[model samples]
Target: MPARSYLYVPGHRPDRVPKAAASAADAVIIDLEDAVPVAAKATARAAAAAALRAGSGGTPLWVRVNPGADDLAADLAAVVGPGLAGVWLPKAEPAALARLDDLLTGLERERGLPGGAVPVVALVETAAGVLHAEEVCRAPRVVRLGIGEADLAGELRVRPDPDRTELHGVRLQVVLACAATGLPAPVGPVETNVTDTDRLAHTTATLLRQGFRARTALHPRQVPVINAGFTATAEEVAAAEALLARVPADESTAVDPDGHFLDPAVLRTARETLDRG
Candidate 1:
């Protein structure tokens, strides 16, 4: 299944890393930017490197690095290694990502790693970055895109509303850019209201409908809800299966019992749903 939920853990909290890895989350992001204080960045990098070395097996493990910070070089040096899956470039700009691509390339070669060994995930958190999202998504090493809600709101001079009306346009733009590049749609910086699980699930469902394949969770309790929202529903799966079963073998098109037209594309989607289960 596509990774649909990413649990964010502060890199400085090494103890949390192991627990996060063992969670049901599809991916875990060891955050070194907003989650880590400046003085503790070095320590966070070291801890994150150790956690990566410990092994995530198959679960995607990514490290979020400060993009426009002076410590980025050192952050890259500490986090980019054989066991690390990818790097999340925060506050990423198109030109900056191009530079990051080069840096990652050189680092991989120097470390005797294969080309494109470490994919970069750009975090579009600024008006400038969102405006140039297409270029950023097309960067050589970029494999995914993300949104930083707080930073984006600040850049756009808007309040961080739970509904995120102001960000809807940029969010759609990011999704479009990702789709155009054949990359996973950007996920959301979901509301961190763990006590309000219903609201959390509702927010996640909204993003899922908008074509996002994943979402970030600050609290462990949010993981399962986010996963549930992103996963294919039983009703949807059943509908897909019913449609596929009605089609004759070797036939690419058919008419459903309801007189609706069915095409190969519909069958393909149905097959995919069952396969996912």
Candidate 2:
């Protein structure tokens, strides 16, 4: 909900759930999909349900359910209840989202919860998911979109360079889809090497420039870097403040003392920068 940092705690590790919730992350996601082993999915589901009831400190708690029908049904049945902030649908596509919406509706009605109360964050990971990104973002109850880089890379057989240039287009596709649908900018993918703070920060900066307002954190240490990356720097804040002071709010166009052209779009960005700061 804060759109700064989303920390992931493996559902099978219930002990880590509270710890993650207490971290600096704006939200915590209990991963019941890739993070859980096939044999332990049931265990993970049960743990996720318990975590939901216990609460997520002050942050929102989301459960990332599996995409498969049987597994997803079990996942929703176990975790869709009080204290659950939303559902993160992995490998999300239009049809899968439709099914999820129906399932959630029935679950909420059966449990006496408010209809459409649960929001969904769709993670587009597969080739089909990426191709149908706009439709996925427009799906019912979908509040946000995210990319699953690892799965996506595997599907496309792309070995990106250190800068991840190969996936740039894919990332932009998700960003454009979110913009077109008027949803908040999509969440950036998690950087798997938790120990590499430098790479984490660099990639986070890249994501920020590419229209991502938040990123997923695989470890608590990654939270600070992500939070900082999304925030406006002092230099950025100063530039924004200067530009705003030079141009009136109602003015659509202006020229600064340095003769730099300022348009409505630039003014809007300045205001947004101040807000972020």
Candidate 3:
């Protein structure tokens, strides 16, 4: 669960699952909703379940389920067994997540798996959902709070601008809510265009700066850019190490080598970053 760069692969495209599972991404999300048509939900669910069973070790595997759909029960039953890491509950409200929690709990018990074996990642897409994001994040199995910008913009009656000015407030709200709840802040629905690597990198860098722990990638090609953006640069790692090295263990605060005042909180973060590296 280290800060991951998750790439989304359409579940119906089982042929692509192997390549996606073997990709450089920290995790791969097998998508059932939005990516798969209603008619093909069953097929996608089976494909995702098969992929999970194939067992791509090391790389975490998550399945994005259709929220509140009648097919969701079957989807959960198909993929919530062993080898599955977690479920990405899309357009999730607190109530929906609560129900999903119950479903996963039942599945775990029925399958003889450890309790709480599967966690949930809630995707907040609407204004109401974002407003109640804290409650959603606080739900029993929620590991992260995800933002779905496309649906959010449609809900808010706005167009998708390149700079994403319209979604900035909502995105910040999601991040702040996740931070307040001690949950991971999800990154953006970055551009799917493989040719626009520069934009993808820029978007990923911006999200990281804003405290997002992980980002979402629609295309596999965007994986490298997202991973690169989320990774700590050598300079950043060196600076963090240098700051921690200069601080005395007993001293809670001190002036750094650069002559800037460093507080205990700052020193702690520096040490944590170095340790993470």
Query: How do the residues 1-277 of candidate 2 rate in per-residue lDDT, one tens digit apiece?
Result: 3479999999999999989988888999999988889999999999999888988767889999998999989999999989998999988999999999999999999999999989999999889999999999989999999888888999999998888899999999999999998998899999989999999999999999999999999999999999999999999999999998898767788999989999989998998898789
lDDT, candidate 1, 59-135, per-residue tens: 77898888864677888889888778798888889788877887888888999999988888888888889889998
Candidate 2 wrong stretches, greater than 4 Å: none
TM-score of 3: 0.94
Which residue pairs collide in model 1, if any? none
C-alpha RMSD of each candidate structure in angstroms: 2.0, 1.2, 1.6
- Model 2: which residue pairs collide? none
Off by over 4 Å in 1: 249-251, 263-276
Ranking of candidates on lDDT, top first = 2, 1, 3
Q: What is the C-alpha lDDT of each candidate?
A: 0.84, 0.92, 0.82
Compared with the true structure, the alpha-carbon lDDT of candidate 3 equals 0.82
